[model samples]
Target: MITRRRSHLRAWALLGALLGATGTAWPAEAHQARAQAPALCTSSREPALAARMSQDIAAALKDRDGTVSVAVHDPGRGLRCRLGDTRLYDSASIAKVLILQAVLGRAEELGRAPTRLEAQRMKAMITRSDNTAATDLWQKLSRARLNRVLREAGAQDTVLGHDRYWGLTRTTARDQLALLAAVSRRTQALDLMGQVVSSQAWGVTAGAPRTVKVHLKNGWLPRATHEWRVHSIGIARGTGTTGTAAVDYRLALLSHDNPTMRYGVRTLEGVALAVHRGLAGGTAARGFTPGHRISETPDGSVPSGAPGPLPPAPPHPPQEWGTFPGTVPPSRTARDRRRAPRRPRSRPSE
Candidate 1:
């Protein structure tokens, strides 16, 4: 019996020594589970308001993975909150809004209205998150022109994509806030953004009071490296006492490395809900309700076999910009088959 006990003890000791040599052989996901949550960094002139927002935002992001950046501005209240607002992420379809700004700015510069083709593409690009339409506009506007618009908007932290991959452009929450402010003040882009297809209007609107007019743009793209980059920016106009212009507020939320698109959307909505509630003096607002009807399609109907709950394709294809004409191009699947299988290229998340 002593010898048997000795053998068992020796076996246990060997196992312990092996484990110690290798440290703990935990699975990758176990390490991820043990990772610390992100810290919320926020500031506002209104100390009480700032405290509330910081607490609310931190609570909303508790235990969530990935990185999220947010910036909020309420001019009437002189309130602002920024949490990781300067961190950059791939812009995805959100860049389409900037493209719209470029298109309008260029038209204003040239002292001409958008041509019929330009109007059509702009409509498709913003309202529907249409990649082909965005590509058409991106090619026409060129990188130099888009960069010029970014500069004019005072969005210093934004970087346009290399070549045709507009979705790959990098931007920060603070930069997006600048873009939102520009849209709010300018009529051209603001008018088109107001018509954002109901199906695509889920982010900032989720937390806003129903009476407020919401102009929003959302971008979502999934990549092998980041899992998903999802972003939303908007201007909200609150209903005030009659005979007064509504109090306008702007918010920008950018996130990357989300486990899924829905998770990212939920995170954004949570942040929005908190901000709107704080801005509205703790009044509760309606949550996100997807529109039954899809907008911006050829027939304004949801395409058959569309991925449920996933964001639409981003504003550029995986390939370089070719000779795109004014007309809307074919769907991605058809285009892929027509071309020779080039080397496997990184697909655009948007």
Candidate 2:
């Protein structure tokens, strides 16, 4: 997996060193996994886990049409898996995540908190995928402000929707990871995302253990050429198995040319389930032991009442961001494939 840049590479190296000190055999194992694994993906610390994830993800794509681009980040374990990482797809309502950030961030810039009505609209925008709410917020949110949010988040491949159509923005898996990383830091923003109506919370969080607190946003749209586009960006956290520290992971899955919305959803769900199993453990958490820290529980997991405060997680290694070979370019027929022809906008999501 490519780290986003040199800095991320250095950060990941630092984490590997820390893991070495902590009796975690992840660094060397991760290196070996990379050497042995296909270019599609890799995992650290556990070759079996990485191989299983790669197989499961590929199986999910088998006999399916359209493209599915995946990027998975596990900072605690120093793991990353990517397939078609930089492939561009329609943002659909996924851009609302950036809109949400712009709204809250603009409020902060204005030297005030988001007002009650703004907060309500923002919550509805994220939790219910409400289009009217998004439109209202978009009217008040300027492109410049949105650019500020994207720049702050390191969303390099994302282009703001043309003529103020946030849903139509073009983006890639790597860039969405950047947006999620920024959103993960703000308590109120993440809280709204976590409150997504159960009906709307259907993508990357699937099969995640109840112990994991999942905050995610999913979007889908149908068009003439690609048929349908479905995408999801998410952050999951739970108690790390090795210590009191928490497990921090972010995943982005993007797809287009699905025959139907449900098919696209299925493609993402299979990959997501495998991811949760691979990272957090399925049936039982594979690496878990009794009596771990409860003091700093971030995901609201049940506390073990162990004495010490939460240990710090391994330093988040920068993601591999070097140029990768498997990227699929945006389709070129409509508007240079930067975007599809504008039509009467449908509701932003399924």
Candidate 3:
């Protein structure tokens, strides 16, 4: 299985490098005007808890050379730990989930089939990080609607500009967590994110344990600086019913302009490890307790038996500039084949 994964990685890597070398252009657009301005954060109950978490994160990130933002949402608590200013940081691929939410919301509003080609685009946006699809969805829903949805979802720091993937959207750790909490509740404002859990995009890959049911979205982008560093964000939802009943938790991280952490998958894995330990009992986490280990790779990288390849350039949304194999010439096949012309299963087979 590992060998097969290595092969898959190599193939994908080739596609990624080729796309990058060839230059798949993603243009920046102007920020859209929203129907109403977003509201500022007014309150949070877990301020003290959040402060401790922030201190821990700050210490852990002392020499990390990048800004780190973290938010934790347990059963009753919605707390965030932020080390840096609450200013918007580049969201990288994480923004795709927001774009996905907007796309799904539009689908719901239009009363159109969620399994249509456009819906497939939403899946691509989330699973594959297709920039063009994100852009298309952005256009379909309009910037105003996107901002309103995000604002209503409580992700105030998330602002969408016209920049292509890895460039346009900015978000803070606090806002990212707020968005995650909103999704967990299935609020009307965040109903679109429900599609992320129901979509079977994760099933296309391997490594995550069958016992774990993950509803997640990931994002990554390389820095334009000379170091050419990478930044990434991952949001996940899993229930203990799947495995390690104690593993139920929300994980989020923001690594700014990381020169050494170029591999998007590795970057996400690091964050996942910290969260898993915090939830599953680890000395690393000053507060959390220990649980069971379902699979070593908690960040939901390659599934079990999946081979590791040199990390490829960040995945681009369709139509946008960035490195995405499917959008490149010669390989007309979409990376997310499951989201082809037909509708896919609404849920993964249990």
TM-scores of the models, in the order given: 0.69, 0.68, 0.52
lDDT of each: 0.71, 0.70, 0.45
Kindly list the per-residue Cα lDDT of model 1 for residues 162-268, writing each as its tens digit: 66777777899999998887777778778788999877887787767655777888887766556667788998876743424466889999987666677777878
Give the TM-score ranking, best first: 1, 2, 3
- Write candidate 2's Cα lDDT for 45-109 as tens digits: 76666666766665565445567788998876767888767878878788888888888888888
* Distance from true location, Cα of 261 in model 1, Å: 0.9
What are the C-alpha RMSDs, in order, of all predicted structures? 18.2, 20.4, 22.3
Residue 211's lDDT within candidate 3 is: 37
Instruction: Flag clash pairs in model 1.
Output: 221-349, 313-350, 314-350
Candidate 3 residue lDDT tens string, 153-256: 87766767552332346677667666665555544323333344322222111123333334555443444331222333333334333344544445455554
Steric overlap count per candidate: 3, 10, 24
Two-way lDDT contest, 1 vs 3, winner: 1
